[model samples]
Target: MNQRPDEDFEEDELELYEHHRILVDKGQSPVRIDKFLTEKVANATRNKVQQAIDSGTILVNGQPTKANYKIKASDEIKVLMEKPPRDTEVISENIPLDIVYEDPHLLIVNKPPGMVVHPAHGNWTGTLVNGLVYHFQHLPEMKGNVGRPGLVHRIDKDTSGLLVVAKTEEAMTPLAAQFFHHTIDRTYLALVWGEPEQDSGTIVGHVGRSAKDRKVMDVFPDGSQGKHAVTHWKVVRRLRYVTLVQCNLETGRTHQIRAHMRFLGHPLFNDAMYGGDKIRKGTQFAKYKAFVQNCFDLMPRQALHAMSLGFIHPVTKEKIYFEAPLPEDFSSVLDKWDNYVKHE
Candidate 1:
């Protein structure tokens, strides 16, 4: 089955438009451009293709083409379309932010757990974007990007960590490019159930939304599904039943670390969505169970944090790095684990 056109595309964080490039097959017969695109582009209807052509967003060989234009073998096609607008308007909220680093071009913020990065279906207010709009007037919004104003990328609402925000378009572009090219250096710290067989290793798999549950991600080791993803991880500490690991991302995908860890038989501790809420290791003693429950209570959410980020300054053309200390809950849980292991 064909995937959505955007599914495999590498979109920049700040891009407001969808850009698609398709190369005609050599054995293809001449066909109407709109008809060809309608068949080639997943979920695209003829009417929508015609509308795109009418708006001159469809180009053949670098020039805008008509709907009725005949597509020849090896013809290069490009489609650019503005993203659809959201139904709800983004209202700026006076939510406080934890600024890590700031400059004229960009700023790094340590987002607390449970705060949405942008307004979405269930999260319509009190998001980081809403606060950003309130704190800074006229922050550069990507053209056609409705709700998000300055975000180049984002972390999950339940995941606490560092995120970089672009203050200007000049800053947004290069930063976005860095993410698209996998040049941004991001390291996450996660406490996961069970110790990995190896002290350090690289996990290579395709990560995509689960077929059974669209809400969460899954790893496709066969490469028959999903986008290519790579995660490098090394054990930082062994907590007997659980392990503290540092993960470095080579390709960013939704829940890449969580999904890959789950695939490795070591789901992140307390990650309910990936089945880490239950005890995956250790003894079945009532005391041990109670102790594990206390650890979960200490940090109810996934034991994951975006601890460090490094990249070339979009404006300065210089490399810079920033790190955020583990949040109180995460730290407290680690302490509990240490004490438990020591006594055992």
Candidate 2:
């Protein structure tokens, strides 16, 4: 897919205008029983033109009308323009990236919080995708597409952490295959409210789309599109009201850590979407409600970080590992928690 098109073939693929704007010339009275188009558009089949007129795409005197509307002499007419050859090319910019490791076949990056992994409706630019495209101008195809460039795995927008990107097709396939086989080592450090009774454990359940809200995921009672998601969490540190846990993903799913942790009664702190208002009291109970509130107010995103990543380097065929320390915001929260506990 990354193969460049032949020069002649590429030149032949030209963008063409869809519609034309024309004014009703003087003494040109409108008369349309059916099937008529202003001299601005082509490929307007009789049936489609009628449908367009019915839908009010055709306008006369700045007002939409059906196909039968008669045009008056010297009246203004505007046809909705259409265009062929949509822009499919992605532009690359030399945005600075936190490159943990880079080689001919792969690149590892510690993606910051709030950096979206891919382009979407509101985030077409300034994404990891855009950054990668810029960094590797001629990055080989991955997953049979050039748009993503080399995206082999993805973390949530707010989850800051190490991610391995394939630079070549050979690297992309193996990395992707490992992820499918659950061989890719991915771990997250999360500040979850409430301490689990157990020291370390696994949370396993079928995760599927939530029935109540399509935007969220829910644990399925009877498994549907729900796939088995597993997370092994070990308590790293216990705060006054929150516990820092290291979560290892056995099977990656949408919001797997967040949903599973929330299901296990330890939703990540300050996760307004899933943690709910009930978790607010923990911050309040710290005797620094105002301070905690201020800190939370200052925080830009979730309290989860991709702290550890281990994988086999595709080109060198050597094992590689990387880790990203918790960002300052999360660290500050922990520091405050420690201070409050010490005083108590």
What TM value does model 1 have? 0.77
Tens-digit lDDT string for candidate 2 (1-344): 23211110100111113254557678775677234463335666777777766545566776667777777777666665323233535667666799998888888898887887765444568888888887786666554344666776677777778888888878877777677667778888998878889989998888765644434667763566567778899999988578899999888777778788889888888776676323444544554666667657656566888898887777777888888888778788788878877876
Give the whole-model CA lDDT for all candidates, comma-separated.
0.84, 0.70
Writing each residue's lDDT as its tens digit, candidate 1 over 227-283 gives 899999999999999999999989888788889999999999999999999999999
For all the candidates, what are their Cα RMSDs to the real structure?
A: 10.9, 10.5
Off by over 4 Å in 2: 1-88, 144-146, 221-225, 276-287
lDDT, residue 34, candidate 1:
88
Clashing pairs in 2: 18-82
After superposing candidate 1, which stretches have Cα over 4 Å from the reference?
A: 1-88
The local distance difference test score of model 2 is: 0.70
Q: Best candidate per TM-score, number?
A: 1
Q: Candidate 2: how many backbone clashes?
A: 1
